[model samples]
Target: MNYAYLSSLFRKQTGKSITAYKNELLIEQAIDIFKKSNKNITEVSNKLGFSNPYYFSRVFKRVTGVSPSVYLSQIYRN
Candidate 1:
């Protein structure tokens, strides 16, 4: 469950560290859930292993340039 060296190994391969790669993947999943699933913000946050909705929202917005609710609304309205 712990991958301290994967960062170095992945960085050596793709020039992107594990932390960055993992965060990118996590953010992508969050977007999928927000746009394609019935899960609420809190539920998606918990399912993604985030500490809480606030923390998840912070990270989600930081990565996607928008809030989870706003993203979800865009999908829902479309």
Candidate 2:
């Protein structure tokens, strides 16, 4: 019920911190949104609950190893 207990359970079940799981979920949502819409990175970032596109891009690249723009470009190239 508390933060510490929940964090422990999360680590035990998934081997990742809660923040990492949330970011992974957000990035997955962002990828789906990006693939479905023609909106720019800022729009996609905002839709995924990020206040700043720059921060969103950093997180996206960290999780995905590529920026949102680059991801979309690759999709287009295929």
Candidate number achieving the greatest TM-score relative to the actual structure? 2
TM-scores for candidates 1 onward, in order: 0.75, 0.92
The regions of model 2 sitting more than 4 angstroms off are: none
State, as a TM-score between 0 and 1, how close model 2 is to the true structure. 0.92
lDDT of 1: 0.83
- Residue-level error in angstroms, candidate 1, position 9: 3.9
lDDT of 1 by residue, 1-78 (tens): 357676677789988877667777998998877667789989998999988899888888878899988988888788
Q: Give per-residue CA lDDT, model 2, range 1-78, as digits (tens).
A: 999999999999999999989999999999988788788898888888898999999999999999988999998999
lDDT for each of the candidates? 0.83, 0.92
Q: How far in Å is the alpha carbon of 68 misplaced in model 2?
A: 1.0
The C-alpha RMSD of each candidate to the native structure, in angstroms, is 2.8, 0.9
